[model samples]
Target: MSTVKDVSKDSLHSTEKVADTDSSGTSSIHGAEAAVFEKRVWWKLDLSVLGVITMFYLLSWLDRTNLGNARVAGLQKDLKLTNDQYSIALTVTFVPYIIAELPSNLLLKVVGPDRLLPTLLTLWGIVTTLQGVIHNYAGLLACRFFLGLLEGGVLPGLVLYLSLFYPREHLQKRVSAVFASSSLAGAFSGLLAAGIMEMSGKGGRPGWAWIFILEGLFTVIFGVFTFFVLPSSPSRCSLLSEKEKEYVIQRLREDGAISKDDRADAFSWGEVLRAFQLPQVWFSLFIFFFHGTILYSLSYFAPSIIQGLGYTANQAQLMSVPPYAAAFVCTLVLSYIADKYHCRGAVVMFCGTCCVVGFAMFLSSHNHAVQYGSLFLTLSGINTGAPTITTWTANNTAPHVRRASAIAVVCMFTNIGGILSTWLLGSLSAPPRYTKATAVLLAFAVGLTLFAAINTAYLYYQNKKKAEIRATITKEDEPAGLGDRSAWFEYIL
Candidate 1:
């Protein structure tokens, strides 16, 4: 078996002294060798792991948000549904959606993401296709509910899955890759919806029906493809040899020094209980919820909002493409900056500011050009939160089980934000400026600013305490089930 390199006696002595007060984990491997090996492993994972996850996320986003395109293309009129009922359908999906995430994440501990995530997409894709043929509002609601039930856990599951492979410092961009793909998917959803909607009446169905049918089937094809390809863990990746895999796993374990608890890696209710006891998880939930309101509002309503700007449905579909494209680019750029600088909270605050500015502009404007421009700013703000927040929380939470559970807990509340957004934007707001909707979303943008700052300050204080604790406590005195509470554990600010 491959092993970590040994430190020189003098070097080991120095590190031991430093470790008594330092919060960062110490590595036995030589720095140069560690860097080279880590670089190679990461390069391979970027190609194999990150790309596949991004593709899955794109497909997921397409399946979830295409309803916006469909709505623009006459789903509401076709189903003979009133606005409140349509909003209820949106809300209904999130109910099961929110309810499913925690258990789904906990279940991820049992099944592994490679096995569980694809099953979710494949099943949801089938449900999505069935939506194309639905005769009435009730069928739409049922399909939506099941879609929620299936799709709810995919994000948190994917987040937890990623936390397994990456060290905390290197996690944001990889996680961003998953969330950023949604923007690309939004763009694709518009372009694809534009093309697919043309198939309307060709098979005795509306263009909107074709949108659902084609996107859903495509999702199924990709989900099945992913099922065969995605590796369960970094050690399982085919790109690395057995030695490299062991080295990779060992280094990751070292990086997560909060794993003082023997039971931490094991799947157990005790770990779940430990996750519930974390204060940071609760703080993260508030930010996730605030961000989710903007996220869901923007993704699910942009096409309709554009159409309401006096553009035709087709025009709205095409117009919806640019802001999301910009958001995708912005998400990547900011993710890089955040990861490079360890500035996740700062980046999140910046994105939230973008939303505030964007919404302020949108609310002030009657001009379609100005409103459209505002979308670029607003959506750039909206789509970037998932990566930053997930990484931030994952960075602080440790051991396999609690991190997984923390991710699920915060993500559950995030979707709950989506439920509220549907009502705020969908039920109460309407065409020609959506004043109430924009205002509420603007308020959420401001809230993101407040909470991101507070959380950052709180984590900074906690990190200081962890450092002090490390100074006072020797390894032999450390207790089990410590997880993130481990004295050696440091929160990323």
Candidate 2:
């Protein structure tokens, strides 16, 4: 169990590995430590962890967003719900979600991912399954709200978990890759839901019930698999070679601190307050709120939107697959670039710009093809930029008390956007098109673009200052010093 300070020291060690050595009274500087071998080791660990986290997240999303499919398959009719009542169901979930977010994230740091995440994922899956059995709107509301409570930790937990395994520079791509699974879930949900809905008359269950039952069951099964398979951190990963573990530790040390231990003293109210005070936290939260507003509103209503274009329910669900697929491709490509360039801010800005164009097109277009293309654009923006922002913000924080607190606070604020989106695109906004929802999404896209720009500028300013400080301090003083010298190296807007 290395202290965060030890981890910090390791990072400094990584930067100095290519030190000057005296040979025959001549100075010779060593080259970087085997970049190819180190990178191969990194990639191996990345693939293993990425595979486990991606599948875990895919189930997480399918359980939550599949409700959109259920809605179209007679859930509202069975509950005798008005549009407002459905929005209320969505809104109620966010209440517990917001309340639980920070607590849950802090708990993840306390208990560690090995025990906490899989347990919560399994519990939420069971809760999701209960929605199928609910006979009334009250019951559905209860299930959804509890589901949110169980799920509140998932995104932030994963963000915090990945921080333990990767460097800040490497994190953006990994995050983007993992988040692309959500787009895959959207596509898969559509495909799977279409099949399940087709089984409407079988087993004496409604199509909506079948959607919940099948998806929920799959989630539980996957959760159990994650428990056995997911690595707690690079230090404990069975698949990594000893050299790889050293490499991982060194790379992480080179970047910033992340914990491998269960940080028991991780929950501090003062640190939590400080997290909230940071402009980076608030900026990302605000952007995520609007980002979620656009993302969930479109994801939940996408099939319905296509159905509004005169297609049947099944046809609409089928049509939903393409945009998600396109988003997946674009997100992965952008993630690779972001990681390669070590420029998360620039990548996110470009993605946000794309979202603006997509949302604007959706708002104004009458042609179905153009509208469908806009779906791709909007998703590319939210899906591509979201993971970058999340990974970027998370990696910028220190480990333990502050990191857990900040992740939770940011996530809590972000989920509020989900609640707001539900209300913004009430069922009443459908049919000829939810003009109100589209317009709001466009406005938010512009806001997010500007926010991303400001965030980029702040990061660049801080980076510039760090460079100046490094230039002032010679390499010899670097190892024993720099504690207060780069103290204001913050990610803020």
Candidate 3:
């Protein structure tokens, strides 16, 4: 098999554009040789790039969702917080988290992910550890707000980060891999919280406090380590030889859109505005908003829901593990299928259906075991659909800054749902089941199902109308003001 080193520099840097501008941009670089070299590059990235992104996401999710675990571990009781106050604490985190995401993503290219991602992780880790030591509601709100501010950039930053290395078609699975960490985060928090609870009376702190301290400290340490190891970009990754680096850069050029090295284009307010103009961006925002309502509810309330199952606090912590565990696996599988089929909406809608069915069961059934069982489906669906929504938006938006703005906007809507869930649904009494909250989440699920199909059809139309225009376009025309709307590009259908 031909290797990356064997490819001539002339072929690697070929000026000739491929006849088919829709795919890779390299005209002379094709067939078994290029294919073999590309796989070698991907395998390296799977280790150095995809692996780190996934690990960082895992740490982030643990810190973000551990609030649910801590709640059951007695955070509220120790703080002497009322339901409204506790909800306020939850709601505060998302406020800064939502508002700052756009600017955060825009800064990713300027600041670079290697520095920006790890810096955010370390700061948030410090904040998370502070959650362990707080004595009053004011302290709690401070920690939560800063935590959100630091963390707001992470998910969108990471999603934007992936587009730097991989082609658009390969995005759904990679995005899924990172988000699956959130499901794993849910499971790990429960198991870790269960163990941390054993340290309850030790160090004169409760189990909930220990949960934050230990998890946060570990994150700080890992964040420091990641800074030295995480590669900056395909262009700067030290693992690749010069030829391999060129191959990697050439790969992105072939896929179209501003490759990492070519991102020197001056940022434009007009390009940023375009992200808001696209109908698909609105569809993606709504999908994220509606889908996030149920997901955030599950992340924040799963332990409480399990506790409502007549289980002890410890048992509730342990039981919350299963639904997230199921979600972790299903997220990987479903997104892989979605990427492979290039039919992302089918998988998204199917997952949304899982949520609708799960929520329907929650509202209709009075049985505790059945309600608990429905959580597996509920969480799995919610987690499964998240990455698809992200990739759908990222795939269509272009040039670095615009995609950044679009992704950040999508994240804002996700947290808007979080605020709604925390303030409205979570404040309700849980005695006999939260019939009202379940009904509301069910409506959001139905909305997700309908809109995934709508966005899919709409993208199909956009691609069809653009196909003929695309056929007449060349590589030189791509950098014009049209951005991703440049005929050199087509929306993923």
Candidate 4:
């Protein structure tokens, strides 16, 4: 709820110097009041866009994970799938995800997400509905692959879209809200799937098939409506006044790594090369890949895993609800703490530790009650860890094309891990003792903690060096190449 003016005024009064230029072009404070006013205006506009974006993210997730629900309703049996066929279906989705990210993000920039995103949502929804009619693995594979291809760029493209709308400091909490909606989807999937499972007598098709038909239809309908409701950017939004649009643009420039008009030209390969040069991009990819593996394995398979524990099919579907509810609560709580403290890396480390402990609990017991309890911990940790890492990575990038390129690159790597995870957690594998899967996930957790720690340490080192460089040069003598940018551009870690 805090305004940009609130932060700017506070910064002005604080000991840290506010950037300014005197007649000789040396650092000094000049007209702080006008600066604060411009900033406050921008903050309000950004928040409105963020609110709409949150709804888009929530629907995007519901569309993606409904397949998990279908799996529970006899999707496998009806298609006459072999044991490995389900894995093929999952792996096929990632192929499009890995291939389409960069191109789709570029397309969003030109066509505008307002037009492109809804088009994608509707197309994928139709594909999802068609999934219910697949008579064999080949049919299911085609649907799943196209579904992945269609939905592939939405997540990263939206992030790039949002970067054009808000300052870096204000970004994390909003990104967290969008990411947390995934947890909400997990909860909603269980509740909706439970009802659909019980509707077996309503239609000749299995209850699981109806789940896809209805959910996909709903998404397609919403997509048609959202195309009209969503805005292209702050400058085009009717929700803000002309004055407010200028303010939002100014505030983002002040806090962002790049200037507001940096992307005014057509898309260029230079931005892509620049993003690829940053070490953080590679680190982000590795971290996302591991977290993606953990998240998808649990998200897609938890109900089946629960069913394996000697519960009836309906009971298994019903039981998926509570852990996801807990996951949703944990996600919001953890995101709030991260934003409040502005401590991204530490939170990820904590989540990594939680994953380790949770998996250990799963490994130690096969009791239905104990395993159920452990699932809450596992789902919460893995889901929370993924968002925290992604939100952190997003905050580190510059504005415009570089941000889009970095996001596409990160998503490209992470989804490959999704393919790995689907195969790693096998449908044919016996229940209650998926020791191999658990062990693989556990190794990932430890790797995550180690990698996050390394990134954090590297950030600390970079900050120290920047401070040293600032200390060595006075305002008048500062090098002109890097311009007047402050040493305050800290990495999210």
TM-score result, candidate 4: 0.89
**How would you encode candidate 1's per-residue C-alpha lDDT over 5-40 as one tens digit per residue?**
323324111121101112454434445655566678
Clashes of each: 0, 2, 2, 2
Q: Write the per-residue lDDT of candidate 3 for residues 1-493, one digit (tens) a residue.
A: 1112223334222322212222444334555656666677778877788888898899988888788788888988888998899899999999999987988988887888999999999899999999999988899999999999999999899999999888776678789999998888899888999999999989999999999999999999989988998888887887776666766666666565454445434577777888899888888878999987888888888898889879999999999899999999999998888777677888889999999999999889999989998998999999988888888788888777788889999989999999988855568746449888998899999999998999999988887877776678765765655667766577775
lDDT for each candidate structure: 0.83, 0.75, 0.83, 0.75
lDDT of 4 at 111: 92
Q: lDDT by residue for model 4 over 23-49, one digit each (tens)?
A: 565443326655564455546655556
| TM-score for all models, in order of appearance | 0.93, 0.88, 0.92, 0.89
True-vs-predicted CA distance for residue 348, candidate 2, Å: 1.9
Q: Give the residue spans of candidate 2 off by over 4 A.
A: 1-33, 259-268, 427-430, 473-493
Error of 3 at 463 (Å): 0.8
The digit string of per-residue lDDT tens for model 2 on 89-178 reads 988877887888778887775687988999988899899888988899899999999998888888888888887787776677778878
Which 10 residues in a row give candidate 2 its minimum summed lDDT?
1-10
C-alpha RMSD of each candidate structure in angstroms: 4.9, 5.0, 4.9, 5.0
